[model samples]
Target chain A: MDFKELDPILHSQLRLAVVSLLISVREAEFTFLKEKTNSTAGNLSVQINKLKDAGYIEVTKQFSKNYPQTICKITKKGIESFEDYVKALQSYMNPGGN
Target chain B: MQPVYCFINRLFKPKFQSMQSENFSPKDSLLLIDSMINQAKNRFTENGFLYLLWGWLIFISAVSHFILLKTRLLKHPEMIWMSCWVAIIFQIIYLVRKNKKEKVKTYSDGIIDNIWMCFGICMMVLIIIVSRNNLWIYMYPFTLMIYGIPTFLSGVTMQFTPLKIGGISCWALAILSTITLPIYYLLLLAAAVLIAWIIPGYLLRKKFKNQH
Candidate 1:
């Protein structure tokens, strides 16, 4: 049994989905992430904060069309962790390395 | 309820029905990442607009130039190139409008934008070279070759095959044009634009619509 431990921050369902979407685009509006992840605004906001606190993502607050806009972008560290997290999952999925 | 809030809720409501129904498994995480990445990579809507615009402009200009020369209908047939200047202005407007409408800037979008900007600069320099050195006879083939550089790279970035194929055809035609008489090179360029820009542009548009 040579299973690898997953990153605790990315192990949850909603958090994992948010990071998954962010990994692809590197940056996305908060609404885009919310829509893609299918998470409630409150829940998505909380997960985004967790990712930011972990230094895995950066959150930008700006104004667009006189409305407050929140944009979330993945940092270098986020990419590294996402890659490692995927690798860990891969090993777990195929422990025999086949 | 506010209209904006209602709109947001309507947009998000459908997604809620299908989510969080399963446990947070590592396999699910892997699947999510794969799907999300594919979604990001397949954007083609804006590409179509750019390709079709430039393609038609160049194609019409080149074909008409060839015709005017062949018929000897105009004393200043070279003036047809002014259309390209008009197209360039429209292209600027298109870019600025796109910039205003674009909300999220992807890494790939930024790279593609820079590639086209560099291509524009090269064309200006080529124009100067031709006007100053009187190398108009040799210019079309060289210009076609230059066009291929960005076209090929755009294909790679968009992961679109038609653009790559289009780019190759431009270079091949350029080589052929170099050996042939310069008079026939305008026709070759018209052919080049049809392949390198118009076809790929429409294909890009189709892909974009399908994705949306």
Candidate 2:
């Protein structure tokens, strides 16, 4: 009778896209995610922080080739949440009885 | 979920040029997810440039070796493979540059790199094995066998048919080289590169360009 409630952490389009991209790759740079999401630095930084706060992603600050690099990686918890979110989405889309 | 959580988080505090995605419906969310996943799936550019470079270099080298052997022109025929050593240096430079240029490193990329690394190790071992024992005479046959391992696995992983077929072709040529005389092994090497590396290299590059 009622649809499943989607996780708010994954509900937003930008955040969801970030998670989706991270799921495929082992790790990605902050700049790489920014480039892929096509979001402004300020905005991407904010969204990344949100995901990090939720324990869904691990952001590491390191130096590569004498330049500061921020790398983002999805955690096991993140993958589980993403999979659950997709299932909820499917349930809502299907409106099934199974 | 309530919008109260958004207030606590530092995210969504600043309004953006396109904040519409911040508040989207289920259908909109679905579309975004689809596009994002597809974007990740479509990244298939790796080794196309090297394949062509190595393919042409080795192809020419193998052919030259065959010609030298047939004509008895050169006092030292092993000099042809020396070009491969130089080409290997160039390949290293190219790979390092490409690694730096790649923004996102996918899981498949790591696996592919390992496969090629293993191939390199095997090649080194073959060189050692050949120098020590004369029984494993026709070097190309053994080389082709080593070549098939990575090429076939690479094709299987990427699901690229040309590579898979090329790999099979290499194995077949390796077997053929064993049955025939050592003189024909060079020709077999040429054919293997043409089918397994050069042709597939061009096709992969074409596919990459078409996607971009």
Top-TM-score candidate index: 2
In candidate 1, what are the lDDT values of residues B22-92, reduced to their tens digit?
Answer: 23455667787777776665544355897898899889889998999999999999898898888888889
Regions more than 4 Å wrong, model 1: A1-5, A90-98, B1-23
In the range A1-98, model 2's lDDT, one tens digit per residue, is 45566787787777999999999887888887887799899988888999999999999887767888888899999999999988876765565536
Recovered share of real interface contacts in candidate 1 = 0.47
Candidate 2 Cα misplacement greater than 4 A, ranges = A1-5, A61-69, A94-97, B1-22
Clashes by residue pair, model 1: none
Indicate the residue-level lDDT of A69 in model 2.
81
Query: Candidate 2: lDDT of B192?
Result: 95
The local distance difference test score of each candidate is: 0.80, 0.83
Going through the candidates in order, their DockQ values are 0.27, 0.44
